[model samples]
Target: MSALFPALLTASNKQALRFDGRALTYAELAATAGSLAERIEGAGRVAVWATPTLETAVGVVAALLAGVPAVPLNPRTGERELAHILKDSTPTAILAAPTDQLPPALAELTRIEVVVAGAADPTPERTLPQTDPESPALIVYTSGTTGPPKGAVLPRRAIATTLDALADVWGWTADDVLVHALPLFHVHGLILGILGPLRRGGTVRHLGKFSVDGVTRELSSGATMLFGVPTMYHRIAESLDTDRELTKALAGARLLVSGSAALPVHDHRRITAATGRAVIERYGMTETLMNTSVRVDGDPRPGTVGVPLPGVELRLADDSDGIGEIQVRGPNLFSGYLNRPDATAAAFTEDGWFRTGDMASLDADGYVRIVGRKATDLIKSGGYKIGAGEIENALLDHPGVREAAVTGEPDADLGERVVAWVVPTDRQSPPSEEELANHVAAQLAPHKRPRTVHYLDTLPRNDMGKIMKRALKSA
Candidate 1:
């Protein structure tokens, strides 16, 4: 496969990006990237800190085009986090937003070249260097639940394979316009949300940050595709009944995709009922952009994440009752983690398959169902092992509940008791605790029912829309 920038440039001469209010065609985008590439020649690593705008996009591709490894930093992160990454990666240059405020340490990196992008500059023409498939092209930081965030090294071949698989499975084309609201610092938004669309000559409209009102406006502006996580979809679903414009705007979208975490089956049904569009939930992670998806043409089962994409293999470890630790081996899998040889070695089995920490089962029709996380998220109570996600899905089906998260709480006799944090659609009209408890008992086994339900106005969430269960536990 060709280099990403070159492949994107060759796709078409038509408009490639729509940001804020302006349109930049493929020719124009390539010219900007090439111009930036000339000024940053010889830089071994380039770090970029900017919002998800067209200029930031160009800076990233330009660094790669110039044969430099691109490191994307979250603008909202603290200076300490920034310094640690810089120290570890030792980037030779930095490309940042033209903001007045910057870390003092950033100023002290005298040996590093810094370029303030999004400023006025003259465009220059330059040729991009040839890139090897094995060469590292992007480094994404993943904040582990317990340790400091580690940079996951993704090679050119891995990214290309992911995009190719997405295009083939979804039938992406230039006619599609993807409305992306997720943060670009993460893999889901960067690879599946941005790269996939651009590689197919499809247009992407970047919403700088997520806002229910702002997203409603973009959807009204005629975006054909929408990608988001479960939390974002829940908020949109809540706003659908009162926001006529949002309802009409979302109705125009041809596809609505959700991932990054398990999407509650209740949210899926509610979003479809409110907007007249079915939500397609797929399974993927930071290590892999996408692996399986609910088919667009077939029955989109609410609980199942659907079949694996072509060229991808899925097998359960230990093969106990068709449910086990999920393992995947494919072209799209990451080469390895950066600087953590031991962790990288442990991530794969002897046969080269990557061991996904998720526990899941495969149905007879080839659909994949995520049972729960292999670690803390799965609870054991009264000698019966239970998947918190299963009970969470049942609680979400309750009409009075807006959101729910199930976790294990300490118990004297049961070993662990199932507890839930719930957010109601109307705080003033909250359901009785007995009502919700009974609701779960009707839908689930006695062992799966939540012993305690705590109601909150909102749930703690990370930038990627994952509920921070640790925070909930502390609360």
Candidate 2:
């Protein structure tokens, strides 16, 4: 019932957003976004060219101010995927930056170019227009593995509830400044990275693109938090040993969070070993903005994505040995897939819980350790439900192993035998199958160890750094 961001109407003119080199204060952002909202205030759904720039943020905020649902289109979206999204959402207008070279699919729609010029102005409403909390705020499309991408319609209440809940859990406040270089099309980067700071009345400094030097520069200056995927954090781990400034910068940060994919325990340990600060981990998807996170004051467990947020109710479905598909019910959950009532109905249970499709287990203390995806990462071998994530983590701990992913292959006796795809630390001398097998066996159970080993220079990964295990079945 409260305003999403009260600061837009009441806060002092302090810096709100800084992307690359450009900065905009709170008053400047309100004036710029407010002026734009007046033009398209009554439009149907609008599509935003979600590049990691100031324009994307402004367009989204303007859509919020205008009480319109904004669909964020990935700038690097392929022709097929772009076509699919455009066809599905049917946005009335496409919002982009002046310099954007848009694809042909968006050419037909009414284009709104977001331009924020000059410093903070003394023009802002004492009271902003009210929008229904149940109204759709954004329609974020999922990366369709089964078929064309399905749009997840997120409500205004979902965003507000999730951010406010995160604030309670993370001790977030107005003084905290966030620094990240995540993309704007996805929930983790856009909703949580950009919107979270704004909702908290804090500042966000985006790196445009992630760089070791850029991260260090921002954190060293005044930033208090860092949000990154495993790939970026892996690079940070690889560099922390020699890069004194990077290590120092990380150690000074109040919080470091990783999400969008499982951050291997090796990377987690490496970063902590270097900086004396544990990187907090959270779990979410396109359908759910955020469900759980490691509390800032709680123990920063290496492999765990901490307890459920304030109002989120989480329970495992069809559990055998603690691991099961995670189903959740919360205000933070999306309303449904846009224009797909059948698909939407299928995503939730008859009891109204959203099926997360990810397999995980809760620890004694309620910490969630996400094993992997149910379809690809849950390996059934030798009558054991072995999570591929644990085996992969064990394989990564090997001295000769640079990267690893585990899978289950069809077998006559075991139903499905465990297979390990490993990237060697050195290409010239890959670890033997037997040696690596024994290494995993020692770390985990014998049935959990890899029955066969395949060597590769790299693992196939998506934009979020999550290993595409489905691709490996063909190999």
Candidate 3:
């Protein structure tokens, strides 16, 4: 319990990780990590900006093994964002490649030392340290939708607890080979994609970046499992017609996981039809690494996100409406938001449950269904509440529609009106506003039907595949 990496290293030995045509075993990974940890300053923060590669993974764990906090930065982040994070965290050094791709401001930070890993370690004087469960390990930044981005601090114990819960719920073993496609900056990719499999003596194949071609190639190369966002799945499904071998390769995958955003029912059916594999959708956020997941061996429901994982507790704040905000409490819960005491205090309830800000309900059988985000996606019109997810799901049923996002538009007549922004597969064959309204009218209640429908070639999305509802409201 004290040192999670050491336990993982002991448990996993001789496992192979396939990277760029080379296979590195767990023993090699451990040795490399131990060597790199000796070079970094002890008990300080290090900013990491690199693509998902074997070297990047080793650097992250090496920093943690030295009792240093690791902060993962998105490779596509701008200079402004990088400046803000550096100013806030004030890391002792930056563990990045010696490339001109870094922001100009980063180059000016002469006080901070920079170490280029992946090559021979010229400075071999540094040494690794033992880590306690309560020690802060990693800091993951959240998408600043409401305001400026804030880093969420996660402890070693929380990460270990999450991995243990995932392994128990999914029955993960050393035999499983996880194909990772998402960006490593996010927690989902870090824990589930990298650490989860590595902890179990299993192999993780890093695809570098998420591309239909890359994933298709990896799957053909004997990747057994895949973890991606819903949009990634949709893109692969859309590209299937161009590459029949991609479809066949995906069909050969043992498991497919969808998360970060809700999977459209239409895309779900398309994936199943093309690959004969039910895409298993899971629920998690930056504050909590993983809470619940759809059963892999049980009935794979299209809309529902399934039950809570082991050692996790989920409850509704107020059950008057049968749907209330989701509250969770578990060992995997994050420590708190970094440097924001008031915000952190407001995020949790008096009873120590973390308020998730997402509306959900548990069925009689204990399956959890995420209704919508409480703050943005729920629309109140004429004293009736409407879930945007329901209307979005119905719109996806139309063959002509490739993607759709539903939001509430300000209306003088009703308090708010249901409005849909749709991206059509064929621009010329886009469904008419009347046809789309009628389509929802047949499936949903009269009030839930979209009164105004607009067609767009593409919808603005965040890095995590969640639709930018704020952009839709302003539009």
Candidate 4:
């Protein structure tokens, strides 16, 4: 197999990565990561303490260069969750910065301090070992909504195919400078945000932590792209009207992408109205690196995640009403759950398509609009298969709503009745249940109106800014 990053070998003095205030040229990165790779060459598997710092990036790149599968452990993970991951993966060694204080869970494993400045006065033309494309590159764990988090083994082929597909769609090239401040444990932040730029031989500037000032500083300088989750974009939208600098910075960006959760239609309109730049939405799971994206050349549809990516085949299961579970078949899909053969076999259909539990619909133009998860967002009220996303969108369009989430409850007559949880813009004068119900009924069918409304100060959200509907339902 060819080298994953050919540019690393044909090294130049060009800047490859910038994290916080430190910068690394391609030459320096090649030398540093290459030397680190030599130290951990034969490890069965390695764990990277995935901090949003330069050392974490170097450690991951080193693991890749050594052809060892890397398991990225989140720093803020709970002790129980961390224990589960370490026990499940059973990595031979754990990699971290010299200054990092590891937890008790990792005390039993071998420690490898990843020093960024190890290769001093290093030369170019560094060598990287080649590995089979189908070999595991990274073992990323899922959110563990149902049970213990499962590690998804992603292959080098999946990474290459997914990044190349994104490049084709986004017009990504060496000239592009990417900017982001996202966690390193997930696919959206690490693989797409970090490795995507490296594959293009482009520059990546990591902000360490996301802030409006940091985003403005990078984009205003020379960064051409900004990658963020819906929460980050929401903050940007809130500040755009007052911060002329932020509006100008966002307007100047060549691309603004959102994923990991749905960007509310209200936020989308506000950002676009403020900066004259629309945010592109993409859809994927940890099991699938990326499936669909609103292309750079395509229409910027607010609700849709555009069409299937290059070399990907997507289908909707049981599409009687044009809404169904999204199933996909592509090289970009993960190999399987690390140790759970039963779960691995169950993830895919006999025909080979990976059954994504999320639900969505297809537009006439082949655009994909995600509705909600099958377990939480699809409410069967009065024998009607209603999607909570449309109702949430309608509720958000009203002036009083700040944040909204929808779920269903058992009903004697309706089988399930739609229930709404909202964070009103004005808590003192929150929209009455009748007004909100009528507001949704006006935009959609009367049957879709919420049978009950619960007002909250704020919606429960995960780290990625996705509303925890299950939590809301339980509450």
Show the lowest summed lDDT stretch of 10 residues, model 3.
Answer: 110-119
- In each prediction, how many residue pairs overlap at the backbone (N, C-alpha, C within less than 3 A)? 0, 0, 2, 0
Query: By TM-score, how accurate is candidate 2?
Result: 0.98
Please give, for residues 1-475, the per-residue lDDT of candidate 2 as tens digits. 1277778876367899999999888888888888778777888889999999999999999899888899999888899999999999999999999999998888899988999766655755533357999999999998888899999999999999999988998899999999999999988888889999999999999999999999999999999999999999999999988999999999999999999988999999999999999999989887888999999999989989999999999999999988999999999999999999999999999999999999999998899999988988898877888888999899999989988999989999999999999999999999899999999889888888788899998999887788888888887
Report the C-alpha lDDT of model 1 over 1-475, residue by residue, as the tens digit: 1367444455345667766765667766666666777777678887776467765677776777777778887888887788778887777766764552556656654333233233223343345678888888888887876677778888888888877776676667768888878887888887777777777777888776777887787777767888998878878887887998888888888888888888888778877888888888788776765788876676678888889987889888865545577899987777777888888899899999888888887888889888777776767688776777888899888989888988998899999998989999789999888888888889988677788889999899898888888889999
Tens digit of per-residue lDDT, candidate 4, span 49-130: 9999999999999999999999999999999999999999999999999999999889999999998873444554445567
Worst 10 residues of 4 by lDDT: 118-127
Query: Which of 1 and 2 is the better model by TM-score?
Result: 2
Residues 1-475 of candidate 3: C-alpha lDDT, one tens digit per residue: 1156543345234555555554556555655566657667474788776456665676676677677888887878877777777777777666664442566656644323233333333333333566778788898888776677888899988898988887776777777888867777888887778877777777888777688888888888867889999889889878877789889888998888899999999888888887788988889898987889877686778998888988899998775446778899999899998898888999999989999888777788888888688888777788776778878999999877888999887888899999999999799888898888888989887778889988898899977788988887787
TM-score of each: 0.92, 0.98, 0.92, 0.98
What overall lDDT goes with each candidate model?
0.77, 0.90, 0.78, 0.92
Q: Pick the winner on lDDT between candidates 2 and 3.
A: 2
Q: Any runs in candidate 3 off by more than 4 Å, and if so which?
A: 6-16, 41-43, 108-127, 241-243
> Whole-model lDDT, candidate 4?
0.92
Better of 1 and 3 by lDDT: 3
Query: Clashing residue pairs in candidate 1, if any?
Result: none
Candidate 4 positional error at 431, Å: 0.3
lDDT of 2: 0.90
